[model samples]
Target: MPQANVDFSLKETAPNIGGGRVSGSEKLTSSFDLVEQMHFFYVRVVRVRDLPRTRNPFVEVNIGNYKGTTKYFKMDHDPEWNQVFAFAKERIQAVTVEVTVRSKETINDEVVGKLAFDIADVPTRVPPDSPLAPQWYSLEDESGRKGGRGELMLAMWMGTQADEVFPDAWHSDAATVSGESIANTRSKVYISPRLWYLRVNIIQAQDLVPISRNRNPQVYVQAMLGNMVLRSRFSPDKNINPTWNEDLMFLVAEPFDDPLILSVVDKLGNNKEHSLGMCTIHLSKVEKRLLPIPVCANWYNLEKVAQDNQNNMEVKFASRLHLRVCLDGGYHVLDESIYYSSDFRATSKLLWPPTIGVLELGILNATGLLPMKSKDGRGTTDAYCVAKYGPKWVRTRTIVDSFAPKWNEQYTWEVYDPYTVITIGVFDNCHLQEGSDAGGSKDPRIGKVRIRLSTLNADRIYTHSYPLIVLQPNGVKKMGEIQLAVRFTCSSTWNLFQSYTHPLFPQMHYLLPLSVYQVESLRHQATQTLSLRLSRAEPPLRREVVEYMLDVGSNIWSLRRGRANLERLLATCNLLVEAWKWFDHICKWKNPISTMVVHFVYMIFVLFPNLILPLVFLMCIVYGASQYRKRPRHPAHMDTKLSLIDSAHSDELDEEFDTFPTSKNGEVLKKRYDRLRSIAGRMMTIIGDLATQAERLNSMLSWRDPRATPMFLAFCILASIGFYFIPWRLFALGVGFFAMRHPKFRISIPSLPQNFFRRLPARTESMI
Candidate 1:
């Protein structure tokens, strides 16, 4: 019966991955048992589509390995609604096809259909040997001839099978042509479907055991040569090293024993002109051995033992001695020991003081204020005057002298006087008048008129000038103008004052007329007008003034003192600078490379002066204290030798008087001495002086006290011993020490306890 054709759909479904539904027209079994042979076959999705709308679904298909595991498919077909069914059969064997139908209407939902096929291994047969097949002979020497050779060749007809098998044969004219025999032969050739034109020298006398005797040697050789061709997959290029050669095979070698030498090339594709000498390996020994050796063994001395074990061997053979290869510029050897040993330390002596020291300095600026000035200048005052005057006129004839005399005796006119007074606090126009005189005459006028009465120097009040004019105009018509002169003088002491108020101060405007006013009647006549003008005196001005002078001596002294202080501060900073440098230099040696003895000697010699400075200061302190204790009560110059003699006699007499019986005068002195001795004896006083001197000496030598010496020496000695014992470990410790040199970790020693029993016994007494 004809079979029913079952349809299959290929599907894929996974999170974030595109899913597809591909339907095949029918389920088809593979023509070969591809699973047994582990060969794959291919298939394609025939059509992929879904729903009523126009949008089409994505389709995917893959060929399966003969083991049923699939390899991803190449995209070969994409159409709006359908995919073509076209893929090779060998790549798609034993297919499991799943179909997925997806749409926006069911975005979260999925439907799947699956189909699988069992593939069978294809049947194959070996061809029968032909009577007409050609024979082959492996090459060998004949009759022991030096240049003897042989050759072999074979040919076969082709087949139309999917995989065709090649022929195998074993024929040799070398040695005995037996399995046990070995020979060196030439002129050999091998040909196969997978390999061609291969050659090998059969030179070793020993026969090579076949890896599998059951397997055909020619087939094995063909597969082996075919793999060689397959693995040589890269393209040949002039730029690549180990330049590809179809006829050549290169051997790999050990990096340490047979290191590949390299040549540098320039941009022009040529070898560099100058020879860069090759390095011959000369490895120093592994430093680990130095760890186990007693630290007492001088590192400088035992280095030869280390060198012997370095595992360095001179290279003897290399397949390709030198090859030109290009390397990226960024390539660098990262081994620190190799780089540091070669580029740095091995080439130079060990530099001492591995650590660095830092110093801090502070700068300050200072200045002063402005200077003061001195005193010198001043001035004096002004003057004033006042006047009053009147004008008149008359006519008389000499013929009527008697009648005129009688008229003169009877004629009297009241005279009104106008005087100008220069007053303070009044405007100039206030004391002014302009009109005719009392006689009503207009012929003569006076611009300025003053009457000189008596000089009132003491009162400072002169009379006003009331001028009297004689009217004698007769003989010559007597019509000439008459003139009058007026004068006055004043003394300031008794000057009359008027209390005139300023216009702005109306409350104080009342006038106080002078009591000493003396009037003088001086005359001028026929005045056109009596005009008076007033003027006020200006007030005195007030001022403040001064002068200055420099005291050069005081300035010089101040300047000198300031300069001296500045120089002293500068000197102090300079001392600190030098000390800082020296101390910093020493502290840097915390990681010194030299031995402890070297450091000890350095500390003793280089630091001795500084250490001794403290000692000298201490000695000076002791000396000062002792001198203070021995301070003289009076001037040291007084009494001189006499005082010393007197002191000696006093001490002796005081001592002797204590023990001996005395006469009346001596007894009285002894009784008084006993009372004085109770206060303080001469012997006790001497002993106290001696004790103080001893104390001073003892205190000054306190640095050498037994306990202090051990502790101080131990610190220095241990630091020194660190240099000898643990070089690397000590280096690490020194790193910490250097870090500690910062303020946060400065080496500050705690205060030491003082010895209350201040003196050391003599060596003899201690021994006894």
Candidate 2:
């Protein structure tokens, strides 16, 4: 994947810290900031005019630092893209739209023409209901002059214009009372923003300054980013080096320019806490490395705060904290990979809907759920379903105290890519009262299923039962099965490519880019709509065929987690064993005659070590030529059929064995027993014959082959006899030379073993 170059100059400035002094309660509340607002905009690449002759021409558009490309249109001077790109407000403030036309070639793509435009130049004063008309702009070359490559057409807009109210209505304090105004306010609008996930892992803290000399200190970590605050569990009975491998996730709306504040504090009496030391981590410095998922794990020096009034300031206690931080781009967009393009024009001909489609999923019910254990020794469970697609999440109402729960709810989602998966999980809901400790009793996860849209046939509704599979610490088990109905409906064929402008499909019509959070909100609304629809139904859906598919005493989850490393070691060991097995099979003595001949040759070599080379040369001329001349014969009558008379009797014997334990008279039983004894004797004879034939065949095949095995054996025998006469250094040098040249004589070895071992550690992870 190509990295997008983003310009950060246009990013919105950080809000200023409040100047007024705050009370104690206000300070506590202000320490944790909630994400309140998001920004969105749209960019449409209309078309590109006349361009120089080039092969496979396409346009690459760069906004801020992110880049996207259009499909290459072969030998077309005027290519129509008509592709719309959306961005979060934070991603495009100071960024310029860099449009470059390039021709794809065998070696590298060549630039045909290039143009740039600052986002500020685009007109944003157009009415909310109307989009700015596409306008042509002159293309420029390296010198910033007209390149004569022709012009490009583009249209840009912000999400604010899509609002129903005009600019004057924004300043009004009173709520609109008209029926139409009331309906509009009740409707939902989805605005997508670029999202980043920041993960902070607190591993351990070293020597620290204790508040009390007599008492052992208990330590915990607090991390602050913007207004969000995350706290780690207190370390078990404070030692000098305390480890808390806890992960904290924070959502970032813009580039991380601020430093993450880490304060290590000591627990005091009456729920009081005192800061021991603190450290500041600047994420901007980490971002410059440009890693896909950057991780920094090291011990950072902790600095004392000026507020500390300890008189022993000269002690200079060495303090540090081990931390690991990573910034991840969540839910990669389909636009990042060309293979899964969501553009209507690119996929229309090959897809069923020939454009974007809608997915309807119905969560019907679950059956034969394993009863969750309760404190009162009662087997019961309150279960609910949570389904996620892209950023959208939907949760069904809890079914109280039922092993077989029925939801009968239906929901719809926008299907952008058919290949993407939708995850649905069932959990045991354990609600706690306010002021109750969360650690008292935790909710248990039931099982989950992931369904891919592409696997379902379009326009066809399927109501099928799927097994709920879960991986527990002990093993994997089937808690129960969920019955679901699903269907995919494509937009009308006539209006598939036309812009949607209906109020019913607000999300599709407005064409505003969405973030993960907005998508989840939309899914929640769909779930509520389904709930409402269910209430109106005459007789709601019910569960059927209560069957439990449970496989106890099997822990496939643990096996899967550690299988990668075990598989690599097993594979390498298998290869080594196979090598020795082949050697043993090829070098075995077949008969007394052959064995005696081999022993005679060895005895001659042992008697005259100086003449070992001469004997080997002579033997090769005689035996090697004879072996080469004896070409192995292929099987004759390979397709011959057995005579009916010869096999007819065996059919009767097969039937007799198939019904061996039949209830028969005494005379019949005696006859059956006698027949079985005779057959067993014959079977043993056949087995002996088979083994003998296999050994003879293997020896014959080895003798007829003109390869390294026979020569290697002869050389080993000669070297063994010669070793006693030759010096140790000379023998070692000869062996090293022979081994070094073995690759030239043998077939090429594969690197599968090397690659497997290299990637094994990454596959096996230790739980933190």
- Winner by TM-score: 2
Model 2 lDDT at residue 565? 29
Residues 1-768, candidate 2: write the lDDT tens digits: 101231111111121112233221222122101111223455667788876666777777666566656677777778897765545455464557788877786466777778777777665542324556788877777667786777878766664312232211211111212212222111121212233445677889988878787888888999887656778899985776788897775554334555799999898889898988888998765432122343668888888845345654442336999988765432222211111112222111222223357766667678878887663679887676766554344555455667887555455677654434455667775542232223454456776555545334445444455655543333235677776655566555333212221121112112323454443333333233333333232221111100001111111122121232234334434646896875555468546566677678779768765566656555554554466556422101101011011122333334333333433558777687657644553453344334323432332223322222243346545664675567656767987887687556753322332221111111011110
Candidate 1 C-alpha lDDT tens digits along 420-478: 11110000111111221233322221111111111111112111211111111110011
Q: Model 1 off-target regions past 4 Å?
A: 1-657, 660-667, 686-690, 693-754, 757-768
lDDT at 734, model 1: 84
lDDT of 1 at 473: 16
Q: What's the TM-score of each model vs. the native?
A: 0.11, 0.28
TM-score of candidate 2 against the unseen true structure: 0.28
